[model samples]
Target: MAHTTERPVREREDASIGELLSAVTSDAQKLFRQEIELAKAEVREEATKAGKAAGMYGGAGFAGYMTALFASLAIVFALANVMDWGWAALIVTAVWAVAALVLYMMGRSRMREVSPKPERTVQTLKEDAEWARHPTR
Candidate 1:
C-alpha cells in the first residue's frame, strides 16, 4: 500500500482571514472593472445612436424650415392682394420656429439621459478601488 501525502493543514495554515478577504475583494474589484468596461461600450453605442438621431433631426429640421419658408412665401404672395390676412405669413413662420425649438429641446434632454450607466459604472469602480486600498478586513 502506497501512502499519498495530502497536506490540507499546510494550505489552511498559510491563508489568513485578511488574505482571504483581500482575495475576495480583489476578485470583486476585477468584476467591477469588467462591468465598467461593459458600461463604457454601451455608452459608446448609445452615443453613436444619439449622433445619428441628431443628424436625422437636423436633416428633418432643414427640410421643415425650407418647406415653411416656401409656404410662408406662398402665403405672403396670396395675401398680398388681401389686407385682412397679411400677418398670416408671420404667424406661420413663428409657429414653425416654436415647433423646431420644442423638438430640439426634447431631443437634447433625451440624449442627456442616455449615458448615465457609464457614470454609475465609473463611480462603482472608484469605490471598489478605494475599498481595495483600505480594506476593512
Candidate 2:
C-alpha cells in the first residue's frame, strides 16, 4: 500500500480563542527559550575572547617580570665591566623601562580588542522584539 505524505490541515477556524491564545503563549515561550540559548552561546563566545585577552595580559606581565629580572641583572653586570657601574645600571633601567612600556601597550591593545557585549544577541533580541510586535510579518 502506498502512503500519502499529505498531512491533515489544522482547523484553526474552529479553534477556540483560548486554544489560539494557548498556542501563541506556547510559541512565545519556545521562542523566548531559543533566544535565551542564543544569548548564552553568544555570551560564552565573547567570554572566551575576553579570557584569551586576559591570558595575553597575564603572559605579558610574566614576560615583563622575567625580562626585568634576568636580562637586567645579566646586562647590567656585563655593562658594568665596560662602563661605570652606576651608568651601566642607569642604561639597563632605561632599556627595561622601554621594554616594559612596549609590553604594557601590547597588553592594552589586546584588552581593547575584547568586547564584553554580545552584539549578535543584542541585535537578535531587537529583532525578536520587532517580530513579537508584528508577528504576521
> Which is the leading candidate under TM-score?
2
Quick one: best lDDT, which candidate?
A: 2
Query: Per-residue lDDT for 64 in model 1?
Result: 68
Candidate 2's TM-score reads 0.84
lDDT of 1 at 67: 65
TM agreement with the true structure for every prediction:
0.56, 0.84
Per-residue lDDT tens digits for candidate 2, residues 7-78, read 222656676777777777877798889888988888888788778777777877887789888998999999
- Which parts of model 2 have CA positions greater than 4 angstroms off? 1-10
Q: What overall lDDT goes with each candidate model?
A: 0.71, 0.80
Quality of model 1 by C-alpha lDDT: 0.71
Worst 10 residues of 1 by lDDT: 4-13
lDDT of 1 by residue, 1-137 (tens): 98843334336577777766666666777796788687878788878868866775786588668868787788777876665565867766786777777767766776775664567667767886788698674
